[model samples]
Target: MPRLWDETVDAHRRAVRAATVEATAELVHEHGLRAVTMSQIAKRAGIGRATLYKYFSDMNSILVAWHEQQVTVHLEQLVSIKDGPGEAGARLCEVVTRYAEITRSSRSPHAFDFPDLHGHEHAVAAQRRLRELLGELIAEAAQSGAVRDDVAPAELAEYCRHALAAAFELPSDDAVHRLVAVVLAGLSASDARS
Candidate 1:
């Protein structure tokens, strides 16, 4: 095939895959994972069942691919926040706030198995990278005396993660922000010194 023809084919394949992934997520969110089927995905994606099968072996595989894409996008967004214009402490505050916001807003009704999906190796690796990113920010803030250095940065990162996860249960944006403030306060060097 000519180069232009190859590019067109590749683009078409990507479009098909993206559509399939999107349709799968929507179907699963609406119908629950156990109730969803490959046929429904194909119909929603505007592709035939045979074509959908050519792209994914089963609904589970499609869900995994969709989740992987979601994780990658989320990682990229956090990385962008880390690299945004700010000092380390400022960036950390912004990233932590944004992360709490993401967690707080992620409510949805789905019957999918979270441990199976989120515990996938790719998801685990992304989570580790996020932890490392948070650790780096904490280390920077510690060196600058913005946060406590009594605890190791990695441990502090873990603490921040656990504390901020409470945002998911918070009732309102005000509650979430208050939770972030508490997390940040706990990390403050002055609080430790007092």
Candidate 2:
């Protein structure tokens, strides 16, 4: 086969896989995990059962694939905000707020808390990357005297992540924002001294 033909085929396969993942998520979200079926996923994904099976043998596999992709996208978003043009303090704040919001949005018991999705290599890698990004931002802010220098950036990074995980059960966006503010404040120089 020609190089162009191979490239086109690869792209088509990726598109089909993406469609299957998205369709499965939508169905699971609407009908709950136990209520969704492979046939429904195939129809919603605009593919035959065989085609869907070719991409994913089961719904759990589809969920894992979707979650891995989501982790990749979320990591990329955090990386962009960390590297975006802003003062260190401002960028750190944005990253913290975004991370909190992501935690809240991804809190679906239908998928996120599934046993199959836990302890996956990609998720572990994404988490490490997130912590690294957060640490970098905190260190930068510390250099600028916007954040506390007393605490190690790595420790502060862990603190921020653990603290923001509460957003998972928060009832409203306003509450999430308040939590973000408190997290950010805890990193401030004055708050650190208190």
Q: Report, for every candidate in turn, its global Cα lDDT versus the true structure.
A: 0.85, 0.89
* CA error at residue 14 for candidate 2, angstroms: 0.5
Superposed Cα RMSD, model 2: 1.9
lDDT of 2: 0.89
Clashes of each: 0, 0
Q: Please, what are the lDDT tens digits per residue for candidate 2 over residues 23-112?
A: 877887788888888999889989899988887888778878888999899888989999999899999999999999999987767644
TM-score for each predicted model, relative to the true structure: 0.85, 0.90
Off by over 4 Å in 2: 109-113, 192-194
Q: Which residue segments of model 1 deviate by more than 4 Å? A: 1-10, 28-35, 111-115
Measured with C-alpha atoms, the lDDT of residue 37 in candidate 1 is 84
Lowest lDDT block of 10, candidate 2: 109-118
How far out, in Å, is residue 81 in model 2? 1.3
Q: In terms of TM-score, how similar is model 2 to the real structure?
A: 0.90
Tens digit of per-residue lDDT, candidate 1, span 1-194: 69999999999999999999999888877877777888999999999999999989986788788878987887888899887787888888888998898777665556225336767889899879989999998999899888898999999999988888898778899998899889998888897776
